[model samples]
Target: MAGALRAMAGPSAQPPSAIRHPPSAIYNSSRPMQLGTYRLIDRLGTGGMGEVWRAEDTKLLRQCAIKILPANLAADPEWKERFLREARSIASVTHPNIATIYNIEQDGDTLFMAMELVEGEPLTKLIERGPMIPLDAVRVATHVADGLAEAHRKGIAHRDIKPDNIIVSTRYVKVLDFGIAKQIGGTTDANLTQGNMVIGTPHYMSPEQAMGRSVDSRTDMFSLGVVLYEMLSGRKPFTGNAVTETLLNIVMHEPVDIAKAAAGITPALADVVRRCMKKQPDQRYADCDELRTALVKSLKEDPKLARQSRIPTIAVREARRLEPEPPPRSAVSSHPAPQPTPAPAPPARGTRAHRALVADDDPATRYILGSILQRYHIEYDEADNGADAVKLLKNREYSLIFVDLLMPRVDGWGVIDYVRGHRGNVAPRVFVVTGVQNQKLSAADQDVVTALLYKPLDIAKVEQLVQKSA
Candidate 1:
């Protein structure tokens, strides 16, 4: 029974010596190929599992990025199957924003995948250079979302979405590395050990993924949320001293307030991230389409806020977070830039404690926002919709107000317009947070809103905005 299971689960056998390795440990070295129909021109890089080489396909006479499994691992039946599965799944996805898989072949014992050679820097490199401009982040994230949407449509979950998996070329953003992806209907019980092995890079795994739960397309959305958060703020939403601790936090802890993580980042951008990081899969945006819609709306409502809100410290920290930490035995030394920690502020006074009113039709969004406010010990009130929100504003005063753009009976924009038209002088620091797409606030509406916080609000960012206004 065990042998039958093994055979059924394992990929077709190939010769072990066929697995290819770079000539030297150093990356980007030029070498000639010893096997296959391709000639290796230069080494691209190596990862934990394999080496990627820039090679010429002699038959096709075209350049390709050939990813090869290490020789030792190639003999392992299960690993080979998993690798082939990943390559085939990635090849099935066809999107402009996703890296294309050209072919998959097993030469002897070595499994190789030839994919579109993207001439560009990884998102990690860009983050290392500095915080991405908000507009640039939005643009890149939109493209990523588009790619994810396509993948999700095909019932494939990326499983690993991190800065390292994203490539930014001059004209396009490509999402790569689908080595851990699984089809929706694939057996969850297949290779239980490998499935539970925590197959993703730390710092970017969603709570569900970290906890070893069966993942769906929503998992990719959460990963994208982390990526988007890092792109805009320049730091990951969660961090810790060790991999286990980091994964534990992802599964259990709420992320640091975005505003606290990076001061001056727009609340709207923070909200988008918060929604993406929703712990429960159902709580996140239904898919990448929803996320893309929210990002596009943010770009339209406050292009400047999106453009100028990038915090450099966040990016530097992200670069440090994504790169593999040096082994203790390594002779070389590299020092990451110092990260500035946000000082804890004194508690707010009774009755006057930085007050906020959250208006949203979605119970989950409101609940999450309320939780964030509670964590910061801020006094806040909730309104089910725009009408209640407007009524609450008239009856009492708040230091800040978070208005959801899409709500029944007078939406966020309507409430803002009403408040400005009638109680212009009494308007508090109004922030419109919404998931609505292609929303453009009129000049009059803009005058009344101090800021626009996008939906799926990041709690840390909300706290920062409240403190800034306070």
Candidate 2:
């Protein structure tokens, strides 16, 4: 539950008041701490906001996270108000991508807020593993932008949008800990004061934020850009040996080009990152929604994400379905009940509409590649092995075939030979996918394959190839 309910930053540097209350009754109890209807099962974490507990609601029998205000802070009206403000900020918006706030309750001196207990690793942990495949990075960024767009629409700006505040689950991503979120155009408060405190993680702060200028929705975009850059390169865009140096870098430095940082990242994707991290807020994406669109357009699907992310294929399908469909034109039935046109034969090679065949023994690869094709409204079929692919090719022609070089039964070489030898005129463009690094194809393979792509495919490159040929 600590993974689910961890809070932002640690306790404040400000000293505790002279009159400290006795050890709270909530913790002193031998049994699990009971705060009204909630049974606090265990302490999850502690931060400046206070302690987080994994709790169960007796009435609903549902698991929840309880963020309790520190006893010392609860005694101070200003701190108490700030804690309540965080709760209110989260409660104002109900979105699938944003964590949910259930209710605010007080148990005598112990005040707490109940919320959804998210189950996932933090984006920080994912980044620690290594740079994510570019497609996955964009997919996560798209979800984050979507959540931010909703919050922005509600006139709230998540002042702290960093990897530590994002949770990535198999089913979906959730933006967490809006403790520092501010309502756009709202009156000045504690956050804006200079020297006393600097809001947000320094490496992710926007130039405007670093200089203590007013902030709006665009501030979040800059932070998101830093995050996306890290996801693609496994490095923060702005960094320093010290906090002040980092802040100065944010204020005045240009980050190393993403392409140089991470090889093979598509230009279109790198541009999206560039636009997002523009020093001036006005120069960044107009809004998070626009950023989300750019992110989706930059790439299609990642094979690794498909296999490991656990994000359902339906999510991609539904996202693609967002494009407006042309309305059906009125049609009059003819008098003689004209026989429906015979199901048209599958289009011949090079004559087909956007259609593809994916042949791979790995079901995960087939699933993801098919999902990408589906997203682009391309018709496609799958074959687990090369022989089935050859059989399918014999009956139904496809404009594109993505075949693994190695497979059970007939190998890719056989499939290529069948296509090259039998197909008289127009042969489907065949792309070879293999796990071998620095693989050197023989002269024969060079003649047969349209292109050779290594394993853990670069999805953007795949998308570009598909768009150009399919």
Candidate 3:
């Protein structure tokens, strides 16, 4: 997982290393060495909005981290408000896991913030090296969630909670950069966003965030789920070739299961990950507190779970590719398998010799899928239940499989478990397309399923996704 994900670049899109400030002499000649009562010692890091520096609070004779808002940005009244809002958001949350904000400074057009100087490394850097020690992974997530729980209780939501924004010091896990935090229940008009635009990093965003919906405390839980998965699996939960595609993936796809990605991930721990990442906000943990309690229980039940760290000591396992098999005739036909008025020739398979399969008990749904596949010129097979799907899967390697959660015989989740655990099984991208009310996947299924969509299936999205693979 780590080997495959080194290419991800995490949520910040920054390299998995902390910014190393150059000599103070570099900034001394041009940028002001002093601002108000603090003297800039050196830069800590920089973002689109501004740079942070290791500064000395000459008035108090103490060291602090200072964030400076860019002059260009300060020129914009809206940005100025957001800058001040950022300060208030951080100041509102007082927790061991959250960095403290001391004061906001306005030196003429230059605006800056005095904050705690954390001597630590970015969690992204640790992730790049591979997964963490299991116990450490749980502790890091629990501590952060606990902190966010308090902030949420205070009606604040940290919209951006990703690896780069997290720092792991020798003794503490500190969440940094609340610059995107929003007051819970704040109007859409109150959002720092320009217009109705959504603001967040695509990779870790919740489906609601991805769709630009009204977000709440659960939004941070979704992002935390992404962080936890990456910490335990050594890979981001959702990823893509482009930003829009990644956002679409978050809203439209299910990530590979963590237990599969890393050997021996416990059911309890996996459940925590699953609930935290539910696409619908209502499907996730009620709040960060609930999430924290679950994390705590998981640790209490199996202290040895920590001993089975997915952190690879030898070589990082590059995720295996899915196998492509010949098409098979589906058993237990539902709705008499849709037959085109005029029998059409089998759709031409792509350069990749792969058979796509659709397994669902619903005759109408199967009919729809069959028709769409025919129009897209993609050859496919169908299964009416989990048992038949497994039988077909065994006979032929599939390139893609769309499964229904509540079919007779074996369930969708059972099929996934079987396929994933099968020896030398080809890794076909599996999607769950169902009308099951509030369908919830087992922790293991979360890692096995590729994408999920609620019925009535969006034929257009199905066409687009299938065509790309084709």
Candidate 4:
């Protein structure tokens, strides 16, 4: 896998100077494990599916990644066929953004696959810090959509399109892992397990996929929408505590408004995500080509993005535009100007009973609540997490509070504990606002909150809550 990944780093299949090399321990210098014309040098990773190794093609004088079926599972005929299916899927398509399969070989009873080495981190790693710049996110999505367009044209539907399966190479955005790819309108790969169960990653599964129904190219589009949403918002659109709950969310719920969830994103770009995630496959773009076109148009319309038909090496860090130099130290003014007086504080909160606090890690949720609070002429304070909400509680007493159940540092439950712990004659009304469903709130949970409001919060209900509290 390391060799294949390295080849993907650039045209030369070498890691860029900026990328750090793996630990020396990752490479085995003992004795080269030879198979056919390839010498395995490094163990990249291992999973339930297969074990990947970085190998040198002695005959071709090139490097690639070899995926070996685990010895334990090699005897299973179904697993063996599925392993071969992955190779066929990759070999069937040839595109700049799609990883290539060079060969599939066997040594005695052991079978392995040699594929193009991609020397870049997965998209999942890139998004770990936070949401990406909107333009860059759009660029990556557009490139991925373009790749899927080609695969779709060849009648292959990549059922799995999560960020982990997409590599952000120095020269291109390459989609990897076609293990679950299904041939459209084919009977062999029906997207089901032995017991009529669905075969797809839970978080990104489309409605049809969640239901274990027949899927087409539209399924890929839905998964892509989930990825794009995560790229823009730094979070998944559908989530729950358990697998069944998550599947339920995917099948039954609408996600928070993207325009509201991700700040500084255009409504047009959000609309593309919206349409792609429609529950019905027929309601989505007719094909990936249409989806790619929409994303490209969005890129062209974004004034901040450089006008280009093709995306540059996305794995490369964005060059920060240097700030303009401050007017060369003015020789005439040796001393700094005196600071201005601070503005007066607002009216005392003790006299007003309509003050509120909105605490949620998501900027979009805060934005929505803040806007709603303003409509009712109620002053409010915003906290990005629970700890900050606690700090705000100490200074002022708000009549109402809207808090998300999950947050960084201290979660929403902690905020409720602080509120309930420091009980006063005039207790503040705490509302649990979140995307997570808790239809049967425990007695303790119900005691702390006045109400449990689900996400995509109803504007009318919010307004009513504010008006009544005020």
Which of the numbered candidates is closest to the native, going by highest lDDT? 2
Q: Candidates 1 and 2: which is better by lDDT?
A: 2
Candidate 1 lDDT, 376-413, residue by residue in tens:
45678999888898888777767667778778788777
The window of 10 residues in a row where model 2 has the poorest summed lDDT is 1-10
Model 4 error, position 144 (Å): 0.9
In the range 1-470, model 3's lDDT, one tens digit per residue, is 22222233233333212212233412334678899999999887676347789999999999999988767667778666767888999898899789999999899778889999988889999889887645557878987997899899999998888998899854467998877788998763433454233455768888876666678989999999999999988898898886666777787779998777656666888889988999888999988888988887775444334234435522112111121232343575332222222234332343324667899875545755666566545678999999999998888777778888788889887888877887243467778887654778777787778778765455446655665655
Cα lDDT, all candidates: 0.68, 0.73, 0.72, 0.73
Position 438, candidate 3: lDDT: 74
TM-score for every candidate vs. truth?
A: 0.59, 0.63, 0.60, 0.59
Candidate numbers, best lDDT first, in rank order = 2, 4, 3, 1
lDDT of 4 at 123: 93
Candidate RMSDs in order: 16.9, 15.5, 21.2, 21.2
Instruction: Report the number of the highest-TM-score candidate.
Output: 2
Off by over 4 Å in 4: 1-32, 194-197, 305-470
For candidate 4, write residues 1-470 as lDDT tens digits.
32322222222211111112233312235433997899998888754346688999999999999987754455777666767888898899999789899999987666889999988888999778677666667767977988999999999999889998888843468998887788999988565353233456778888877766788999999999999999887889998765566677888889998876676566678889999999998899999888877876664443233222123223212221221222444468443211211223243235535588999975545766776565455688999889999999998888888998788889988998899888566667789887655556678768778987775455446655665565
Tell me the deviation in Å of residue 22 in model 4: 24
Residue 469, model 1, lDDT: 53
Tell me how many residue pairs clash in candidate 1: 15
